[model samples]
Target: MKQNVWLYIGEKIIMFVLSIFILSLIVFYMARLAPGDPLVSYYGDRAEKMSTEEKARTMERLGLDQPIYKQYGIWFKNALQGEFGLSYKYKEDVIQVINKRAENTIWLGGVSFLLIFLFALVLGSFCALRENTILDQIICKLGTISSCIPPFWMALLLILIFSVNLGFFPSSGAYDIGKANSFKSRVSHLILPLTVMVVSHVWYYAYMIRNKCLEEIRQDYILLAKAKGLYVHEIMWKYCLKNIMPTYISAMAISVPHILGGTYIIEMVFSYPGLGTLSFESAKYHDYNLLMILCLITGIIVISCNTLGQIINERIDPRIQVSEVSRYGK
Candidate 1:
């Protein structure tokens, strides 16, 4: 068992390394392929008028004169050593730029994730318990509609309703500029964006969980539990929930990274000072180093969460054979 666990972990580590390498290569190439020069973001209109010699000197300074493979090699080596290069646009270390914004993103994402799960759990379970009832049908329709609506559009509608019409909630910005340092002011500013995030995500998860619950509830084991005279709530909570946990964990793991990434749009809509906002600005200004770091961070988050979720699922359900999973993947 210990040997299998170690082998599973070793496989995951190998996969992680390979995924990072491939993702880093793609990020490097995509940044280069994108239109606009980093020098333009650095020096603005002056870049267009610079002489060939000046351009060459500037490129040399930024190491842009190096061959593409050489540049990637240097970047990969530096990244391995915890040295993400400087941000040309920010005039700061890549880490510093990311750190300044990461906390706000974490807070926003964390709150949104918690709300999504909590709400999904309650609504999903209730709908499943009341399956085929009017309430279940209503919730199902609502989930369908919510899934169809784009998140950005929902964000706009929320801003229009709550911030504009209702005279509540700030439409944009992390906090009022004058009271920016106050925790209360920041929390007030977060309400609209947080609501937008939660509303946009909750229904789909709820619907999915509801269906999973309904399916599990109809299983033979659940029927057997009911025959044994177990309480409905006990059967749902203990048997049904446990059986569907792998699915729940898998979904959460897959979705968390997306939630983190989705903050780019949400933060942009609200002008919140988070990783998403930072990412938008970085891409807009052609800040390759900053963008690269963001991509790397996102890749790590997704891969780490997925691996962790799989490990937890395997531990919880010993029936899941790592060797079988590996063979299936092959």
Candidate 2:
């Protein structure tokens, strides 16, 4: 047990380091191709009129005049010591800005994700159990239709319906200016975007869980339990649901990454104080430091979730081997 724990920790460290290295390489390589000199992208039209000496001085300041790979080597070395250079827009240590925004994004994600998970599980079960009935057909259609809509467009529709037409919630933003720090105020502010969050996630989770539950219900064990005089509800709740919970968990693991990614759109539309909004603004302004950081974070979330999902899958279904022998050979 101790050895397995140690191995798991070591594996996690290696995964984290590998993720950082690959992301750093991609970011550095992409930064090198920012259309023009770093100094030039920052300066715009002023870049064209600069003297060769002036350009050389500016390039030297950004370390842009050096060979691309050499510059990346230095950057990576400094990054190991916790330096991400500087932000082009904020003109501050990029780490501080990233840390703050990361917290906000994480908070929003946690709340929204939890709410969506519970909501999806319940609603999905309802729809799935009612399969072939009119209610099921209607909800199934709705889920399919809702899943097709882009998250951003859905945000807009939500704003129009709830804030403009209904006048029940704030149009955009996360909190009231006066009571920004109050929990009550934050909850009120959260309702609109959270509504969007639920809308975006529910359909997919419901459909996946519903299908998984349905499949489990048809299994031999479930049939045997039913034959042993178990109530339909008992078979569903105790037998089928518990049996398929691992798959439900895997589906959730798949969905969390998507939840993080979805915030990029919903957060932007509402101008919510979250990391997704930060990413959107950075991309628009060509703020490569911020953009790359957020993108890397996004990738980390995705990879970590999938890896953890595999671990959970292994735990629940030991027979479901992860690796398989290749059928094709020379």
Candidate 3:
């Protein structure tokens, strides 16, 4: 058992490292190969005015004159030493640029994440408990429609309704300028984006939960519990809901990237200052260093969350762990 545990940890570590490495290679090569003047991002209008000789000297100074492979090698070395290089667009260290905006993304994404799962669990269980009822059907239909709508479109519609028409919420940004520390200002600004985030994703997960709960309700143990005179609500709350928690947790972990992507899209539409907006600007301007770090950060989060979900699933269901061990002959 100990050996299996260690083996599992080792495998996950290797997989995580290899995934990041491959991701780095892909982003590095693709960004360099993409058509753009990265120098323009760094030097602005001055880049276009520079003579060929001056441009060559500038490229050499920035090490862009090197072959792609050599540039990657140098980047990988510096990355190992925690130097991710400067953002060509921001004219600052990539980490520093990210740090300034990371908080907004984290707040938006984290709040939405928690709300999504929280509401998913409640709505899912509610629908499961009242399956085939009028309320359940209505919820199902509404959820399906909402989930089908594109997040960006939903964001715009919400902004139009709540921000433009009613004048109830701020349409863009994480907070009023200079109100970063003000909670009320933050929440007010968050309303439109959060509404879009929640509306767009809540039902999908809720539907999954509803199905899982219904499946649990039909199980032999549930039948036996029903025979023992347990109420439907009692059985659902105590058994069906409990049984599906591990699966729900796994789904939450897997949905990080999905939710993160949505958050990014919403940020862009709303002019929110977050990694998503930064990512767009970096890619648009061909800020290679900034784009690379953003991609790496996103990739790491996605891969780590997926791995964590798998580990949690295996832990909760020992049969899965045993099967993995046997499959690997560990």
Candidate 4:
């Protein structure tokens, strides 16, 4: 059993490394091959003013004159040495640019993630407890409609209503010009983006939770509990809801990427100055080094979360581990 556990760990590590390598290779090649003058990203308008010979020297200096494979080779070599190079557009270390923006993304994404799950649990339980009643039907419909609306559209709508017309909130940015340290300013800026993020994703998870609760309620043990004179709310709260906690946890783990993606979109729409906005700027300007690091960071997060979700699922239901072991002869 211990040997199998070790084997599984080794397999996951190997897969993670391979996934990162492949992701890097794809992004590197695609970025380089894409039609753009990266020199423009680095040198700005001076790139156009340079003569042919000067342009050649500039490209050579930036290592853009090399073959695509050679460029990737150098990048990979430097990356392994913990030197990811500088952002062409920002003229700063790629890591520094990311560091400056990462905190905002973390704060926004983290808060939204917690709120999504919290609301999902409450709304899901509410609907399940009231199953098929008017309240349940209304929540189901509203949730479905909200989930169907595109996050970008929802963000724009909120900005129009709350920011433009009513002048209730700041339209864009993480904080006011001089209020970076002000909690009130930060919260006001966050309201619209957070609303979009939570509304866009909460329903999907809530629907799943609702379905899981209903399934649990229909089980024989729940029937037995009912015969024992337990009230409906008592059975749901103590037994049905408790039984689905593991599944709820697994769902949360699997939803990290989903929520992160929504956060990115919301950031872009709101000009929130997070990694999402940085990612867009980097790609648009052909900031190869910055783009590579951003893609790798996101890829690592997404793959790690998915692997973690699998691990949690297997741990919660050992039959999953047993089945995999038998299938793979490990």
Candidate 5:
């Protein structure tokens, strides 16, 4: 068993490296193939006046004149040494740019994730227990409806209601510029964005969990437990949840990067100062270095989450085979 586990780890490392290599290549080519050049964004209004010779020199200086394969090699080599290159738009190191913006995202995304997960688990279980009842049917219908709504639209609606009409929350920005950055004010700014994230995603997760719980409740062990005089809620908490946890962890981990992707729109709509908003700006300006680094970091997050998910799955349910976990690639 130990040997099998070690073998799985080796395979995982190889897979992760290969995945990163492929993803990086795709990101590199796609960014280059896009319509505008970084110089346009960098030079802004002055770009059109630059002569052909001047543009060539600028491209050469930025190494954009290099062959595609050569550019990839140079980028890969520099990346290993922890150099992600300078951002054309920011005129700063890519790592520094990312560092400056990551904290706000962590705070916003973390709180939203916790709330969604907690509500999904509790409410989903309740709905599953009362299957066929009016409450279960209503929740199921709502889940289906909510899943169809775009997150950005929900964000806009929240801004319209709470921020524009009621004046209960700030419509945009991470914090007030004039205030002393009190927790109360910061949280006030967070409310609309957080609500958009949680509300948009919660019902979908609950729907999925409800189905999983319903399936688990039909298993023989649950019936046996009930026959042994175990209460429905007790069997659910002690046995059913234990069986359900592996799936929940796997789903959550795999969705982390996607959730971050969703945050891009929400953050942009709210003008929140986070990685998502930063990425949005970078894309608009063709900040190649910054955009590529953002993609790389997101890919790494996905790979790391899948690895953690597999490990946690094995710990949660020892009966889960290594073969089963190995199939769950990010």
Candidate 6:
């Protein structure tokens, strides 16, 4: 039976609004708790030497003189209208500065995400097929080691090998912004960071996929197919894959947030130009606006991915989805 799309949309809208409210509250309190005062830093070392009248004037101009509730009301209003307010550190609109860096970060994340998906899907399937063979044994060991190493440690190791010792890749920074070069020049520079990021993402999901595939192979469907004279390859390529579809997509979707929020160490170690670097610098410099905005962005991305994964898994297996709705709706 057809359900009400409007009802679904209404529910989603409510959830979205509530999420924004919760995020704003958390960000506001977290910013307040963080060390240092934005005002003192904004005015410079001579902030204490400034007159009360001068200080009051500056606070009034920035709207910081208002009560906390009133300040949040104004900020929330503007934020809903797409005006994110000004940054004390950059002396520019917060959204504008963030957008500039967001483009590069999104691009890098997207490319790395694709590499991760492809690597995990192909190599994971191959490993599953070769289970109990030397190839599978080697892959399992390697994956375990790769997964065991922390992302930061891997990043430092890469830096030591590629940047510090060999000097093959630039240690930090994006590219020569002004230097004229072919399209290849920009892409080549991204290889090292992208490689490290992809490897980190790939192994986690690949192991999950391997385990999912193995479990799927034990299902009665596989036994039925095998008893029907199906080839082992055919059973794996078709039945086993179909069975593990949910697990694969779910695992991949879960990684989306990690990839988005992570890269801090990688960015810091490699000095890559991305949100990770921006967040680090903002926190170090006590740029409250930037720090809060980055946190908000990261939260939104993670929540969005989780919601997407739920929706997708439900759609792919409507029996479970419908059961869930029925259980909750009543």
lDDT of 1 at 184: 90
User: Residue by residue across 220-273, what tens digits does model 4's lDDT show?
Assistant: 999998999999999988998898999899999899999989889999999999
List, residue by residue over 1-330, the lDDT tens digit for candidate 2: 566557666877798779878887887687667564455446767888999999998879877788878988887788678777776666767677787677657667888899888888888788767878999999988878877888788888888998899988887666687665688777776787777788777888888888888888778987898889988777788777887788888878877778887776777888887788877666655666666677777887888888888778766774654231121111
Q: Evaluate model 4: give its TM-score.
A: 0.97
Better of 4 and 5 by lDDT: 4
Worst 10 residues of 2 by lDDT: 321-330
- Per-model C-alpha RMSD: 2.9, 4.0, 1.4, 1.3, 3.4, 2.7
What is the lDDT for 142 in model 6? Answer: 90
Model 6 segments beyond 4 Å from truth?
1-3, 40-53, 179-182, 220-231, 317-319, 328-330
Ranked by TM-score from best down, the candidates are: 4, 3, 1, 5, 6, 2
Task: Estimate the TM-score for candidate 2.
Answer: 0.85
Model 5 residue runs over 4 Å out of place are 1-4, 178-181, 227-229, 310-330
Off by over 4 Å in 3: 317-319, 328-330
Steric clash pairs (candidate 3): none
Per-model TM-score on C-alpha atoms = 0.90, 0.85, 0.96, 0.97, 0.89, 0.88
Candidate 5 per-residue lDDT over residues 92-121, each given as its tens digit: 999999998897888788888888889999
By lDDT rank, best first, the candidates go 3, 4, 5, 1, 6, 2
Local accuracy of candidate 6 as per-residue lDDT tens digits, 76-106 = 7887898777777777887888877776686
Query: What's the CA RMSD of model 2 in angstroms?
Result: 4.0
Query: Global lDDT of each model?
Result: 0.85, 0.76, 0.94, 0.93, 0.85, 0.77
RMSD of model 6, in Å?
Answer: 2.7
Write down the worst ten-residue block by lDDT for model 5.
Answer: 321-330
Better of 5 and 6 by TM-score: 5
